[model samples]
Target: MAIDSDYTVNSGVTTGVIGMQDPLYLAPGDISGLNPVASPFNDKHYLKWSRAVKMALISMNKVGFITGKYPKPAEIAATYQDWIKADYNVMCWILHSMIPEISESLLYVQSSKQLWDEIKDRYNQANAPFLYQLRKDVMHTIQENNQSVVNYFGKLTSV
Candidate 1:
Protein backbone atom coordinates (compact mmCIF):
# COMPACT_ATOMS: atom_id res chain seq x y z
CA MET A 1 0.00 0.00 0.00
CA ALA A 2 1.32 3.41 -0.99
CA ILE A 3 -0.55 5.17 1.83
CA ASP A 4 -2.42 7.18 -0.82
CA SER A 5 -5.27 4.78 -1.31
CA ASP A 6 -9.02 4.26 -1.21
CA TYR A 7 -9.29 1.62 1.48
CA THR A 8 -10.78 2.14 4.93
CA VAL A 9 -8.22 2.45 7.68
CA ASN A 10 -7.17 -0.33 10.11
CA SER A 11 -9.69 -2.77 8.73
CA GLY A 12 -7.23 -5.20 7.18
CA VAL A 13 -7.29 -3.08 4.08
CA THR A 14 -4.08 -2.71 2.15
CA THR A 15 -3.92 1.10 2.22
CA GLY A 16 -5.24 4.34 3.65
CA VAL A 17 -3.90 7.65 4.86
CA ILE A 18 -0.88 7.69 7.09
CA GLY A 19 -2.04 7.50 10.67
CA MET A 20 -1.74 10.22 13.33
CA GLN A 21 1.10 11.71 15.45
CA ASP A 22 3.16 12.75 12.44
CA PRO A 23 4.29 15.84 14.41
CA LEU A 24 4.09 18.01 11.36
CA TYR A 25 5.14 21.65 11.73
CA LEU A 26 1.85 22.79 10.21
CA ALA A 27 -1.03 21.69 12.33
CA PRO A 28 -4.40 21.11 10.61
CA GLY A 29 -5.84 24.50 11.54
CA ASP A 30 -2.73 26.26 10.33
CA ILE A 31 -3.81 25.68 6.75
CA SER A 32 -7.63 25.97 7.04
CA GLY A 33 -7.73 29.29 8.93
CA LEU A 34 -9.12 27.80 12.11
CA ASN A 35 -7.82 27.50 15.66
CA PRO A 36 -5.55 24.55 16.27
CA VAL A 37 -8.11 23.16 18.70
CA ALA A 38 -11.17 24.19 16.75
CA SER A 39 -10.90 22.35 13.44
CA PRO A 40 -8.87 19.73 11.57
CA PHE A 41 -6.93 18.66 14.65
CA ASN A 42 -10.15 18.67 16.60
CA ASP A 43 -12.05 15.48 17.32
CA LYS A 44 -15.24 17.18 16.13
CA HIS A 45 -13.56 17.34 12.76
CA TYR A 46 -12.71 13.67 13.19
CA LEU A 47 -9.08 14.44 12.37
CA LYS A 48 -10.03 15.12 8.78
CA TRP A 49 -7.64 18.02 8.52
CA SER A 50 -4.92 15.99 10.13
CA ARG A 51 -5.27 13.29 7.54
CA ALA A 52 -5.46 15.84 4.75
CA VAL A 53 -2.29 17.53 5.92
CA LYS A 54 -0.53 14.19 6.00
CA MET A 55 -1.47 13.59 2.41
CA ALA A 56 -0.42 17.11 1.54
CA LEU A 57 2.93 16.61 3.17
CA ILE A 58 3.46 13.31 1.45
CA SER A 59 2.78 14.95 -1.89
CA MET A 60 4.65 18.15 -1.19
CA ASN A 61 8.24 17.58 -2.23
CA LYS A 62 9.57 20.89 -0.96
CA VAL A 63 7.68 23.25 1.30
CA GLY A 64 8.24 26.79 0.09
CA PHE A 65 6.39 28.63 2.83
CA ILE A 66 9.27 28.09 5.21
CA THR A 67 12.03 30.66 5.03
CA GLY A 68 15.14 28.76 4.09
CA LYS A 69 17.66 31.03 5.79
CA TYR A 70 15.64 33.87 7.18
CA PRO A 71 16.72 35.39 10.48
CA LYS A 72 14.22 35.02 13.28
CA PRO A 73 13.59 36.59 16.65
CA ALA A 74 15.28 34.73 19.50
CA GLU A 75 12.07 34.38 21.46
CA ILE A 76 10.29 32.86 18.45
CA ALA A 77 13.19 30.53 17.79
CA ALA A 78 13.41 29.52 21.44
CA THR A 79 9.68 28.92 21.62
CA TYR A 80 9.67 26.36 18.81
CA GLN A 81 13.22 25.08 18.47
CA ASP A 82 12.53 22.42 21.05
CA TRP A 83 9.58 21.06 19.13
CA ILE A 84 11.49 20.97 15.88
CA LYS A 85 14.56 19.48 17.50
CA ALA A 86 12.57 16.89 19.40
CA ASP A 87 10.56 15.93 16.36
CA TYR A 88 13.71 15.72 14.26
CA ASN A 89 15.52 13.81 16.97
CA VAL A 90 12.79 11.19 17.21
CA MET A 91 12.72 10.83 13.43
CA CYS A 92 16.49 10.51 13.24
CA TRP A 93 16.52 8.00 16.05
CA ILE A 94 13.94 5.89 14.26
CA LEU A 95 15.82 5.98 10.96
CA HIS A 96 19.13 5.27 12.65
CA SER A 97 17.55 2.35 14.44
CA MET A 98 16.50 0.93 11.07
CA ILE A 99 20.02 1.17 9.64
CA PRO A 100 20.98 -2.38 10.55
CA GLU A 101 17.72 -3.82 9.24
CA ILE A 102 18.01 -1.97 5.94
CA SER A 103 21.65 -2.95 5.56
CA GLU A 104 20.76 -6.57 6.11
CA SER A 105 17.91 -6.39 3.64
CA LEU A 106 20.07 -5.01 0.85
CA LEU A 107 22.99 -6.76 -0.79
CA TYR A 108 25.34 -3.77 -0.50
CA VAL A 109 25.46 -1.74 2.65
CA GLN A 110 27.13 1.64 2.34
CA SER A 111 29.05 2.03 5.55
CA SER A 112 29.11 5.31 7.44
CA LYS A 113 32.38 4.37 9.15
CA GLN A 114 34.42 5.56 6.16
CA LEU A 115 32.58 8.84 5.93
CA TRP A 116 32.95 9.47 9.66
CA ASP A 117 36.62 8.61 9.48
CA GLU A 118 37.14 11.10 6.65
CA ILE A 119 35.47 13.81 8.66
CA LYS A 120 37.55 12.95 11.74
CA ASP A 121 40.64 13.05 9.59
CA ARG A 122 39.74 16.50 8.31
CA TYR A 123 39.27 17.96 11.78
CA ASN A 124 41.86 16.12 13.88
CA GLN A 125 41.78 18.56 16.80
CA ALA A 126 37.98 18.91 17.02
CA ASN A 127 37.35 15.31 18.02
CA ALA A 128 34.91 16.21 20.78
CA PRO A 129 31.47 14.63 20.50
CA PHE A 130 29.27 17.67 19.98
CA LEU A 131 25.55 17.77 19.26
CA TYR A 132 25.93 19.80 16.06
CA GLN A 133 28.73 17.61 14.77
CA LEU A 134 26.79 14.51 15.71
CA ARG A 135 23.86 15.72 13.64
CA LYS A 136 26.18 16.21 10.70
CA ASP A 137 27.58 12.74 11.23
CA VAL A 138 24.11 11.27 11.21
CA MET A 139 23.35 13.08 8.00
CA HIS A 140 26.56 11.75 6.54
CA THR A 141 25.55 8.28 7.60
CA ILE A 142 22.15 8.58 5.96
CA GLN A 143 23.67 9.94 2.79
CA GLU A 144 26.08 7.05 2.73
CA ASN A 145 23.21 4.61 2.94
CA ASN A 146 21.30 6.21 0.07
CA GLN A 147 23.68 7.06 -2.71
CA SER A 148 20.75 8.17 -4.84
CA VAL A 149 19.69 10.65 -2.16
CA VAL A 150 23.18 12.13 -2.12
CA ASN A 151 23.31 12.15 -5.90
CA TYR A 152 19.97 13.91 -6.13
CA PHE A 153 20.94 16.57 -3.58
CA GLY A 154 24.30 17.13 -5.23
CA LYS A 155 22.69 17.28 -8.64
CA LEU A 156 20.22 19.96 -7.59
CA THR A 157 22.69 22.04 -5.63
CA SER A 158 25.81 21.94 -7.67
CA VAL A 159 28.62 24.38 -6.88
Candidate 2:
Protein backbone atom coordinates (compact mmCIF):
# COMPACT_ATOMS: atom_id res chain seq x y z
CA MET A 1 0.00 0.00 0.00
CA ALA A 2 1.18 3.49 -0.80
CA ILE A 3 0.87 6.38 1.67
CA ASP A 4 -0.61 9.57 0.24
CA SER A 5 1.65 12.61 0.07
CA ASP A 6 -1.06 14.76 1.54
CA TYR A 7 -0.97 12.64 4.67
CA THR A 8 1.99 12.20 6.98
CA VAL A 9 2.38 9.41 9.49
CA ASN A 10 3.21 10.40 13.04
CA SER A 11 6.63 9.52 14.48
CA GLY A 12 7.55 7.59 17.64
CA VAL A 13 7.51 3.80 17.50
CA THR A 14 5.01 3.25 20.31
CA THR A 15 2.61 5.93 19.11
CA GLY A 16 1.33 3.72 16.26
CA VAL A 17 0.26 4.93 12.84
CA ILE A 18 -1.65 8.21 12.94
CA GLY A 19 -2.09 10.34 9.85
CA MET A 20 -1.83 14.12 9.91
CA GLN A 21 -2.62 16.76 7.33
CA ASP A 22 -3.67 20.34 6.73
CA PRO A 23 -7.16 20.84 5.42
CA LEU A 24 -7.50 22.18 1.88
CA TYR A 25 -10.20 24.51 3.10
CA LEU A 26 -12.32 25.22 6.12
CA ALA A 27 -16.03 25.09 5.35
CA PRO A 28 -19.01 26.29 7.36
CA GLY A 29 -20.65 22.91 6.95
CA ASP A 30 -17.67 21.30 8.66
CA ILE A 31 -18.89 22.94 11.88
CA SER A 32 -22.42 22.03 12.92
CA GLY A 33 -23.27 25.59 14.01
CA LEU A 34 -22.14 29.16 13.46
CA ASN A 35 -22.31 29.38 17.25
CA PRO A 36 -22.26 26.19 19.28
CA VAL A 37 -23.14 27.18 22.83
CA ALA A 38 -25.54 30.11 23.23
CA SER A 39 -24.42 30.52 26.84
CA PRO A 40 -21.37 28.52 27.80
CA PHE A 41 -21.18 30.00 31.29
CA ASN A 42 -24.65 28.67 32.09
CA ASP A 43 -23.19 25.12 32.01
CA LYS A 44 -26.29 23.78 30.31
CA HIS A 45 -25.18 22.79 26.79
CA TYR A 46 -21.44 22.75 27.25
CA LEU A 47 -21.06 18.99 26.78
CA LYS A 48 -22.98 18.82 23.52
CA TRP A 49 -21.51 22.03 22.17
CA SER A 50 -17.98 21.01 23.09
CA ARG A 51 -18.42 17.65 21.38
CA ALA A 52 -19.69 19.34 18.23
CA VAL A 53 -16.80 21.78 18.24
CA LYS A 54 -14.33 18.91 18.74
CA MET A 55 -15.83 17.03 15.82
CA ALA A 56 -15.48 20.11 13.67
CA LEU A 57 -11.87 20.59 14.69
CA ILE A 58 -11.06 16.92 14.07
CA SER A 59 -12.69 16.94 10.66
CA MET A 60 -10.68 20.01 9.70
CA ASN A 61 -7.40 18.34 10.83
CA LYS A 62 -7.09 21.07 13.41
CA VAL A 63 -7.49 19.20 16.70
CA GLY A 64 -3.77 19.26 17.36
CA PHE A 65 -3.79 23.01 17.05
CA ILE A 66 -6.10 23.12 20.05
CA THR A 67 -4.39 20.29 21.94
CA GLY A 68 -0.92 21.80 21.60
CA LYS A 69 0.39 18.67 19.97
CA TYR A 70 0.66 19.52 16.28
CA PRO A 71 3.30 21.09 14.10
CA LYS A 72 6.10 21.69 16.53
CA PRO A 73 7.96 24.74 15.30
CA ALA A 74 11.36 23.05 15.43
CA GLU A 75 10.15 20.15 13.29
CA ILE A 76 8.24 22.17 10.73
CA ALA A 77 9.47 23.96 7.62
CA ALA A 78 10.03 27.71 7.30
CA THR A 79 6.38 28.17 6.37
CA TYR A 80 5.38 26.92 9.83
CA GLN A 81 4.43 30.42 10.89
CA ASP A 82 1.77 30.61 8.23
CA TRP A 83 0.34 27.28 9.32
CA ILE A 84 0.29 28.45 12.94
CA LYS A 85 -1.47 31.65 12.00
CA ALA A 86 -4.10 29.80 10.01
CA ASP A 87 -4.72 27.34 12.86
CA TYR A 88 -4.87 30.19 15.38
CA ASN A 89 -7.48 31.98 13.30
CA VAL A 90 -9.63 28.87 13.14
CA MET A 91 -9.27 28.36 16.89
CA CYS A 92 -10.24 31.98 17.56
CA TRP A 93 -13.30 31.65 15.33
CA ILE A 94 -14.42 28.61 17.29
CA LEU A 95 -13.84 30.42 20.58
CA HIS A 96 -15.80 33.48 19.47
CA SER A 97 -18.76 31.23 18.75
CA MET A 98 -18.81 30.03 22.36
CA ILE A 99 -19.81 32.80 24.82
CA PRO A 100 -19.01 36.49 24.93
CA GLU A 101 -17.56 36.37 28.43
CA ILE A 102 -15.26 33.49 27.56
CA SER A 103 -14.34 34.76 24.10
CA GLU A 104 -13.43 38.24 25.34
CA SER A 105 -10.99 36.78 27.85
CA LEU A 106 -9.15 35.00 25.05
CA LEU A 107 -7.96 38.21 23.43
CA TYR A 108 -4.39 37.83 24.70
CA VAL A 109 -4.10 34.04 24.47
CA GLN A 110 -1.37 33.30 21.95
CA SER A 111 -1.91 29.57 21.54
CA SER A 112 -4.98 27.47 20.80
CA LYS A 113 -4.28 25.13 23.73
CA GLN A 114 -4.27 28.03 26.17
CA LEU A 115 -7.68 29.17 25.00
CA TRP A 116 -9.00 25.62 24.91
CA ASP A 117 -7.71 24.77 28.39
CA GLU A 118 -9.12 27.91 29.94
CA ILE A 119 -12.61 27.25 28.67
CA LYS A 120 -12.42 23.58 29.52
CA ASP A 121 -11.13 24.11 33.04
CA ARG A 122 -13.76 26.71 33.76
CA TYR A 123 -16.79 24.79 32.47
CA ASN A 124 -15.90 21.10 32.39
CA GLN A 125 -17.03 20.57 35.94
CA ALA A 126 -18.39 17.26 37.21
CA ASN A 127 -20.17 18.50 40.30
CA ALA A 128 -23.01 17.01 42.32
CA PRO A 129 -25.86 18.46 40.28
CA PHE A 130 -24.18 17.45 37.07
CA LEU A 131 -23.71 13.89 38.29
CA TYR A 132 -27.25 13.72 39.62
CA GLN A 133 -28.60 14.96 36.31
CA LEU A 134 -26.63 12.33 34.43
CA ARG A 135 -27.94 9.59 36.70
CA LYS A 136 -31.49 10.88 36.35
CA ASP A 137 -31.22 11.04 32.61
CA VAL A 138 -29.85 7.52 32.38
CA MET A 139 -32.61 6.23 34.61
CA HIS A 140 -35.43 8.02 32.83
CA THR A 141 -34.24 7.32 29.30
CA ILE A 142 -36.20 4.79 27.30
CA GLN A 143 -35.75 3.61 23.77
CA GLU A 144 -38.62 5.37 21.99
CA ASN A 145 -40.87 3.22 19.80
CA ASN A 146 -39.64 4.88 16.62
CA GLN A 147 -36.02 5.37 17.66
CA SER A 148 -33.36 3.29 15.99
CA VAL A 149 -31.16 1.06 18.17
CA VAL A 150 -28.05 2.99 17.14
CA ASN A 151 -29.67 6.33 17.99
CA TYR A 152 -30.85 5.01 21.33
CA PHE A 153 -27.38 3.80 22.16
CA GLY A 154 -25.88 7.09 21.12
CA LYS A 155 -28.26 8.99 23.36
CA LEU A 156 -27.49 6.73 26.28
CA THR A 157 -23.75 7.13 25.90
CA SER A 158 -23.94 10.91 25.50
CA VAL A 159 -25.11 11.25 29.08
Best by TM-score: 2
- Superposition error at 86 for model 2 (Å): 1.5
Backbone Cα, N, C clashes tallied per candidate: 0, 0
Off by over 4 Å in 1: 1-90, 93-98, 101-159
lDDT of 1 by residue, 105-156 (tens): 4223222223223323433343345546656655564344547976857744
Query: For residues 1-159, what per-residue lDDT tens digits would candidate 2 score against the true structure?
Result: 121223334563222222334432344454423453343434466677777777767767677767766644533443345456556666665766766666777767777777778778877887898788889999999999999999999999977
User: What's the residue-level lDDT of 98 in candidate 2?
Assistant: 62
Error of 1 at 137 (Å): 34
Q: CA lDDT of each candidate?
A: 0.33, 0.62
